[model samples]
Target: MAKYKIKINPKNLPVFDKYWHYQKSVQSPDIDVKFFRKAYKEIFDKHAVLLREDFCGTFKLCCEWVKLRERHEAIGLDLDPEPLAYGKENYYPKLNSKEKDRLVTSEQNVLTAKLKKPSDVTVAVNFSYFIFKERQVLKEYFQNVYDNLGDQGLFLLDIFGGSDIFDLPEEETEFEDENFSYYWDQEDYNPILNHGLFHIHFKRKGEKKRKNVFNYDWRVWSIAEVRDILTEVGFAETRCYWEGTDKDGEGDGEFKPSEKGEAHCESFVAYVAGIKK
Candidate 1:
């Protein structure tokens, strides 16, 4: 693994933020906020005014949520202070006075953090919850979420699985406009435990690849397993929102309620929503 380096030369005049690049390449906070707001209304027959973003890196979703409605408020929780500080410095400055006041972030663990008030919606997206590899611990975390949600609150999670992720040990994606390439490196996997060790690497043009910018040791849970856990944790019902396929048979970015999923064609992403009674 190469160490991170900055080209300290007059020739390289532009400054860059790797986190910004990561968000642009992989995250769609705008779309996420839209879906959450709309889904809440459709599911509960009422608008959701409060959202709690678990494992919210950079709290981008929190920033977006406050922007959706003046009455909306958001809280973001993460154990790391680095990204939280980054959000305070970069993303927070972009918010107006009202939005800034509505968005709050805390450096705390998801399992034990105390919210000022119960949340109307709790979201753990991007497979961040996979860090809890143990079934008991994952259920405990879900239970904590359930305990903190208001009546009829929803819990949302995004998950991915398919033949492609299992077959490939490593995959690379290039973003020409961003001038960087991202790599997903699977170092090892245990079939017996369904555990995997993975790392994220990045390389800018004309520079050495920076390895292990982010690493995850995750236990990939199936949809059925997750739904069962949510149910056990006191969610009255659960539903899956499967992504639609485009002409090329790739995910088209539109997700809708599904009882059955599309055929497993190498890879897929889906959202699971747990509704509180």
Candidate 2:
């Protein structure tokens, strides 16, 4: 009897799209819209007409903003071409002509980008500004945002912190419907500098794990410290929006302005908004 060899066919293997996976797992554009708009109305007692999204990977937030109202406009700024191209090809095409005209994006740095008009709101979420580990650089970036905002404008950013962030080595989240697993690997941390190395990896079902889908070298900034820097950089006032907890102690998806945060959680995410005088 002849022995037959078992073959592994490449065509039958699983495929992974990191950006697609990231949007599903991490971003909630609809929620961001509600928060941004509501926060604006609460702070300034008026509607925000234009928004600028700094370090806006894929510009999904900008796309969503234009959809909110006919007069609403959005601008997205980023230095990378790959994600910008990805947004142009994927998300931009989904918008109608009116929204397409209302939304604009540029391949430029947040620190020096020039816009035709100042934005009513500028957002840098997902801890993207943590890239500026130095206090001076971060303050400089904040000052630029301050100078570029319209009167009564606001700058919003999201940050995560807790005792566990420094201690947790790694975390894995599985999406059964998407047929993949996401991993956040905290490879290194320096207590002295408050800096950390993080990597995002993905594993498709029945496939080998992919490493370093995204990587970040960031200094973990405290909420208090960030507020101080915003004030020092010329923001008239700084506010924190703390997320409420459900019965199970998980974030209940509602954020209200608060000066004091709740006690003792493994990790928490909150928004800090800087109001221009």
Top candidate (lDDT): 2
Q: Evaluate all candidate structures by whole-model CA lDDT and list the values in order.
A: 0.88, 0.89
**lDDT per residue as tens, model 2, 122-177:** 99988999999999999989988998899899999999988787785688999999
TM-score for each predicted model, relative to the true structure = 0.93, 0.94
* lDDT for model 2: 0.89
Writing each residue's lDDT as its tens digit, candidate 1 over 1-277 gives 1123323457766555667767876789989999998888999899999999999988999999999898999999999887887788778889999999999998889988888799999999889999999999999999999999999899999998877666646788999987899888888777788887888888889989988888899998888899999999999999999999889877888889998886655778899999997
- Position 213, candidate 2: lDDT: 91
Clashing pairs in 1: none
Cα shift from native, residue 155, model 2 (Å): 0.5
Could you give the C-alpha RMSD of every candidate to the true structure, in order shown? 3.3, 6.8
